[model samples]
Target: MSLYQTSPAVAEALAQGRPVVALESTIITHGMPWPQNLEMARTVEQTVRDAGAEPATIAVMDGTLYIGLTDDQLVALAQAQNVAKLSRADLAACMAMGGTGATTVAATMIAAAQAGIAVFATGGIGGVHKGAELSFDISADLPELAQTPVNVVAAGAKAILDIPKTLEVLETQGVPVIAVGQDALPAFWSRESGIKAPLRMDQPAQIAKAFAMRRALGLPGGQLIANPVPEADEIPADVMLPYITQATAEAEAKGITGKSVTPFLLQRIFELTDGRSLKTNIALVLNNARLAAQIAQELSALP
Candidate 1:
């Protein structure tokens, strides 16, 4: 069985040594409702293309690791029910068992590295969850970044998580936490997280150089590029805090745990925000896609 399959556009780009950005499929399957998910996926891919790179959206379908999806495949995945949420732990096992799954940030990074693509774009990555000290419910995304050599571009850890603890964990693991165009780390739907980013890069090319230098120096892991949501699209951290706190309290009261916690909180927050969070999510994802493409282009230009 083929270990992976690349879409025609991605294959051609690889063959021609052009820039290619990998995208995770979980946002389509688990992050949003149907038609909007489909629309966002297409728009993100087009944004990368418009920025002079090919977009390779990775997923596992019927035991195949797809580096990119055809239009029909994308629609099918978006509308499909009960898609497995894949990560580093179960990616190959799911494929070996001929299961269908949507890739998360961690799984997408692994897939991108396997496919020789060095950059990935997503809305936000999972991190240390609230009450992690008690529940020990850290995200696989952190460990995946510790080992996978694929640079990830995102808004930040989802604002609903324990952002301070997330930063501390990243520090302990020595993962590069970079804020793009600012000194403050970004929260997913908000422009600021009120925490200082360990590093700041004002240019996409500079960020690309940092990735290249790490590789050249035989570094094991990749960098995290935290790009803030556009100001006009932001929900503002102060305004969002109360809603997140209330939603998190509800989760704790109901004993929501593991994978269910995030989606639950997100859905509750959505209801609380009257559906504005999803709109910001789509915008930030598109922004990350554009930046990831530029970084990929710069990497391609490097010796």
Candidate 2:
């Protein structure tokens, strides 16, 4: 028996050598609430399709690594309670145990590479948490980018994280962090991180060329393309910083540690921001999906 399963849409696209954008499932399961998650999932997949590529939404269900989810599967995963959030550490373990899981950035990249999908789109990737020097609570997504060949597109590190430390860790791990259309790194929910991007690329074709060249040179990891949310949809960084600071402080006070920290912070920010953060998050994710599809198309057009 095959170790994985592929949906007909993805199988057809792959057979034709067509471009396909890999989407992480955690955005559906853990990123948003039920009906909204389903709505976002459908909208994102449609966004990719509209941008001229297939959308491969990855997850593990009943011991099968599904490269692309069918509509019913998408609905099931979105509404399922207590779905395991799988990362590099336990992706295989979940499969072996016949458990269902939504893939985080690290797990999604691994699944994308295994399926020969070269591009992934998400709202943001996890990064070094605040006070990582003491807790050392860094996310596996950083190291996964250092090794996985699938290019990931995101708004930036979640504003709730330590952005400078995340970038520093990625730099140390030899990951290419490219800001799209600007020199400033984008903060999730905001168009600017207030920190200059280490690298910048203005076009999808240019980004595609870099991805190809890295593969040609046998580079181990992939690129991080930081695509900012549309200005109309973004909240300024300054407006969000205080909320983030407050939320982070609250989490520390509550002793929220490990994997629970991000979700807890996000939920608090959602409340603090009067749900505006989630709206911006959805916008950025849609923007990223569109960009990732263009890159995938550019990649498919290449040799």
Candidate 3:
């Protein structure tokens, strides 16, 4: 059996050296409600195509690692229950056990690198949870960025996380967190985190060149392109802070830990915000998809 499977469109694109952006499946399987999740997945994929690249949504189904999903597969996975959330530690094990799984940022990067894909887009990355000093619950996504050579475009680390500590961990891991069109790192649903980014790039071509230069210098890690959510779609940081704090407090009080923390906080925030948070999330993800497509195009054009 082959180590991976690819949809016909993605396979053709890869064979022809066309631009392709890898998408994570956890956004579909674990990030949203059933029909909304499917709709978001479709929208993000179409966003990539509209920006002139193929979108390869990665997932594992019945023990098979699929580099891209068909339409039916997307629908099935969206409505599937009890799907494993796979990251670096459990991705292969999920496949080995013939279990269906959704790919998190770390797992998606691993699959993207394995399939020779150079770019990925998502709403946000996991990061140091608030109070991680004692909880020691840093996310796997940070270390994966330090080692995987796939450009991950996102609004930024999820605002629910400890943004300052997240940046510190990224810096310590040697991951280049480059804010696009600004110096301030974006705070997922908000455009500015008040934390100055260590690096900034104004254009996709500049990002592409940096990516190539890193490879030339034998750098093993990928870059994080922090694309801010469009202004009209964003909830100001001040407006979001209280909702985040309330949700975080709820999660802690409920004793939610491990993989359960993020989804729980997100759901609580969604409720606390009267559903506005989910809308902002969808907007940011689509925005990242467009930027990731542009970066992929530039990467493909490189010699």
Against the true structure, whose lDDT is highest? 3
Ranking by TM-score: 3, 2, 1
Local accuracy by lDDT, each model:
0.94, 0.95, 0.96
In candidate 2, clashing pairs total: 0
Collision count for each candidate, in order: 0, 0, 0
What lDDT does model 2 reach?
A: 0.95
Which pairs of residues collide in model 2?
A: none
Model 3, position 160, has a per-residue lDDT of 98
How high a TM-score does candidate 1 get? 0.98
Candidate 2 lDDT at 155 equals 95
Candidate 1 regions with alpha-carbon error over 4 angstroms: none
Candidate 1 global CA lDDT score: 0.94
Candidate closer to the true structure by TM-score (higher is better), 1 or 3: 3
Candidate 2 per-residue lDDT, tens place, 1-303, comes to: 787888999999999999999999998988888898999999999999999999999999988999999999999998898899999999999999999999999999999999899999999999999899999999999999999998999999998999999999999999999999999999988999989999999999999999999999999999999999999999998999899999999999999999999999999999999999989888899999999999999999998
